[model samples]
Target: MLDVLPIFSGDDRITRLFTLVPGSDFEADALSAIDALGGHTVPWSEACDGTYDLVVAASPKGDLSQLRGPHVLLPHGAGFNKSIPHEGSADSASGLDPAYLRRIGHDDTPIALHALAHPHQVARLAATDPPAARHAKVIGDLTLERVLTSAPLRDRYRASLGTGARKLLALVSTWGPESLIQQHPGLPAQLAAQLAHDEYQLALVVHPNERSLLGTYELTERLAPALDAGMILPDSHEEWASVLIAADALITDHGSAALYYCAAQDRPIVSVHRGGGELIPDSPMAVLLGRIPQLGRAEDVAETLRAYRPGAGHAAAQAAFAPPGDAVDRLRTEIYALLGLTPPAHDVAARPLPLPAPAMRVPAAFDVHVETTAAGFRITRHPAGKALPGHHLAVEHGAADEQLARSAGLLYRRPLPASAAPVDLAWTADGWTRHALSAYPGCRSAAALLPSGECLLRVRGHERMYAVQTEPRPERGQVVRIDPAVALSAVHARLLSPQPAPESRTMLNCLIGERTFRIVLRPATDTEATHVI
Candidate 1:
């Protein structure tokens, strides 16, 4: 009889049997636990036992070559487990493996075994409780549950979370001398006494490898006093959580620790990430980092901490923790079913609906009317809608270039980096070119420059009138007019045309409303103007 009570798979209600080969009682115990839970079992033999569908063998000298088939192996220990993956073709057992399961056989007959203690039994084998709550009861009675039960109540809860009167900021500090070195990289050796100061407590939890070097006098001077203040150098997750739960705000160098603390506490986190380090947009760390705002200064952190209020923040945090509808429960059920186990009949309760996706301010797409000649490149702009596509040109009457330049704002002229590909432009007075453009610089206009002068302006809606006063020397009124073929009104015709490449030798400045665009008029090259300016 095996004690399956220690390895109850959480959420995965699948039933499966397991056992270990002779001479490995330690592994046998683990396998017995697995088998007692309802997993299928097969005898390991020289000829390979056909009595069972899956044969598992555990031995230092076990011949795995004969045990070959589409089978999964539960190797004992991480080192041996990793070796199995590298050496044998068998899929080694791991908790995450979709096939480390209970159901088996071609006929799909359900294997019967002595029932395991329950899913929560896995905690007995763990050093510490896993962060994600195991029992529904623990989460069901949370304060979040109250707020989630009603819409108006939810709103009030969220608003309260955001209404902190003071922010209690905490900066996590490590103990090792290397940690001290990281914190104060520029401490002078000569003025050591003068520089000896303690502003905050340091919680020094250092890895064994870092303990030796931490005994330096200089490191002690820098770190000890802070610890005396209230700083903690905690090594374990529990310790870190305790500190974070009490502190109003958190600051950290990396994103993972910060995320765990923030999500658990619903505390506002300020990331003090390493300079020049950017979290990848698609990674889990990045997803977590998105929740916290980045604060550049310790003072800012102190200020925010001074105003933080726990109860108020709890509602917002609870709302954040709540899932969309009963999606989480549904998912939990599905995962268990897939693992070949009957899910428990946990009662579902009503909760507030998920908040809507955040509103984003997306700029309107642009239409470009372009033409090039011996003089320069010309372009116009208008909003994205097709209602009046070719009817709106930035340059109207006597004020095309200036109006376009002003509308373009900083988009008109940009210095190309030395490493970038060279640009080309062709200037012709007649048969001008037109193109639709997007991400035009200024709010409503395009950028353009004509032979008349340099400074830019804005072109009104659907009208061929440009407006702005760039140069003030002589009386070149703020706006001027250029060719109408490449005017803002001609945007539609340009967009409808097939894209062509610009000549390598032709480079010119393009003006779309007030923004200036540098277009390489490479006829034989892709005309997708890499926005330089």
Candidate 2:
């Protein structure tokens, strides 16, 4: 079952008959009009048993909670003339409120105008004073009960109307010749004119502005030869609906008439660019509708309209704008998984190896890498990478013959800070040494120094340590290779001794992974080696 909840306000009986109505114009008159048609006085009672499987409302004032069923029609207005009457059991003025009209004219009440539903007599109305036909719906903002009239065979009426005349009608404004050009700089003028012409015939109905002859003149002059002349312009809402209900397409500019007409009738549409090339981001038309195609050039307008014909290829065309395959395929896969089915094998790759962990903890120091295991714990003492949470920092060395096993672990409460630097490490083979740099604030720190005779220095030297600073480089998940010889030359390092003596000598500036360590060459003099090394 299809559920539709349309809001309208014009005739009170339609509201009283349905579950919900969006209010529209001529509130008091609309109620009287519906009262005159239904003949039966409806009492204030909530009907919610699906007595009617479908609820059709034309005004916005009717409450939808009263009916539990499918709804059709949006209780909105498309400037339908409710003050005028049509030659039928329904009277226009009676269906609308005179007081409401006065309030609206006086700006005391802001109300929307709706079109009346009557698709059968559109062609006849157009042949006469089309504006005089009152075939449109009206919805007032203040009351929904004013316009709801019980139309006994609305479904049958729709079905029958679908087979007659044109399938859709679009109303648009034509202000200037450059309007189309400004919107679509790439389009040609002649093509746009033809598309507009084709939209009228292929669509069930069309209502061009009577005040402006530029659009009509252009259509009759340049596009008339190639078009079917059966398409006629109607001036009234009655004629608009008669064509709209049966139309395959509705093409128009961004006018309120086009906006509410397509919305109220549930018609597919094409909106031409009317003003500046750009559309307002928060415009009402964009918010309430979709599937609107653009028609800028004269030659393509007609073809664009023909493409949206009800049975021609709307589904495919619409799919071109919004594809429908991804969600369905995803659902199918999920359903199979729920059914305990082995999913079909596809090309999938293996995961990559993880990086090392932080050698030690330091507050406000991020980018510490570390990895702990039962066999042993490995820590990368660098401040330039990430480490997993819950890594073991301290390890218990194995007994005389047993293998080493990690016993304790620490999970970090937050991510490590990147602002801290790794200065040095002091250690024996047993476990992690005291690693230090600048203070890590409330965290442990230890700085390994060069031998006493050699001296500890910054990137520059001990003399310039207070002023030494490094430049930032772009390195994300990467390793850069460098040669010691070239690096020494770049930093202008001076050798302390021609070739270091044994035991006390080593390349103190070499950085391996995260920890900085040196390769010992030979021992220093007895006196020098005694105190360091």
Q: What TM-scores do the predictions have?
A: 0.27, 0.25
Would you give me the overall lDDT of model 1? 0.32
Worst 10 residues of 1 by lDDT: 190-199
Task: Please identify model 1 stretches exceeding 4 Å from their true place.
Answer: 1-168, 172-223, 264-268, 282-301, 304-332, 344-533
lDDT top scorer? 1
lDDT score, candidate 1, position 419: 51
Q: Candidate 2: where is the Cα deviation over 4 Å?
A: 1-171, 174-228, 264-267, 277-281, 288-291, 298-533
What tens digits encode model 2's per-residue C-alpha lDDT throughout 397-513? 121111111121111111122334477432321112111122122222111122221311222112211111112223455333322211221122222223322233333333323
